[model samples]
Target: MATHFEHLHAVSASQAYKATFASHEHTPSSSIKVQCPIEVSFSDDTQTQLAYFLRLLKQASQQSRWVTFIGHEALVDKNLLQSAGIDLNKVLVVCNKKGHSVQELMIQALQSGNSSAVIVTGDILDFTSGAIRDAAILSESFAFVINRQAKQQMTIH
Candidate 1:
């Protein structure tokens, strides 16, 4: 009887573990969207920053939608993207040639449901991250604001 009870407990524990982890797993077709508008930063002095960016971009491209880039065309080279295993056809680099502002473009892309992830790089501040978070939730997508900060230094305004 004790052995039977132990077996049932083991099964229940394993089931709980699976349930806990399944929600955190990323899938292209998953309805449970992840929290978005995640802010990340990298300094020019760091050697591993580009690698981290590539890894994150690769993961974001796993969805059916496009992985869009804004204001970072030089970094999104064909060779680099290919090395990251991201589909070249699914990648987009938009220039700010239009009258619309970069923030405006970011919000639109996040809410359009056409992009799996929208990545921007620059010294973009002064806008509200909450707005991006809301748009991301509405479209069930990811928004990455990659702030290229000062190189291993800080300044006070």
Candidate 2:
């Protein structure tokens, strides 16, 4: 798939870019990091999910980069992921309680190219497709956890 940033830039209005880019206040050292959020279902013994995370984590660790995780429940799963071979420091946890909006987190991740991957919970499902698309435009890969409960939110209508 095309990088998130590419997709976003393709559709984002110059005004929107000016607003976001202006707020960023780029510095001489400022850099852009790309992230692509992938949504994965969490089921019994999520070893496969954990393994996927671990593989990415290890690769990023090798490059001295880290993966930032969003959500409280996600953090719990990440703990289990450690057993699958994740480096603790290479996995930074940021719960929603930290009072960061998804957009804020994405921007922070983009600025910190040191993070190779970013994982967020289904809470992000509430964002407008435009926002998610924009995030994809800015990221290399993005991971989203779509819990079984989330599917129940759908109506038969």
What C-alpha lDDT values do all the predictions have?
A: 0.57, 0.47
Query: For each predicted model, how many residue pairs clash, with residues at least 3 apart or on different chains?
Result: 0, 17
Worst 10 residues of 2 by lDDT: 9-18
Off by over 4 Å in 2: 1-35, 45-47, 77-79, 96-99, 127-142, 146-157
Q: Of the candidates shown, which would achieve the greatest lDDT relative to the real structure?
A: 1
Model 1, global lDDT? 0.57
Per-residue lDDT tens digits of candidate 1, residues 34-124? 4434344444443344565565566667778888887763245679789888887888887787887777888888888898778775543
Q: How close is every model to the real structure, measured as TM-score?
A: 0.64, 0.52
lDDT, candidate 2, 10-124, per-residue tens: 2212222232234445321122233234444444444354344454444444445666776555554555566656677677777665788765675566455556556555543
Give the residue spans of candidate 1 off by over 4 A. Answer: 1-34, 44-49, 72-75, 149-157
Q: Report how far off residue 124 is in candidate 2 (Å).
A: 6.2
TM-score of 1: 0.64
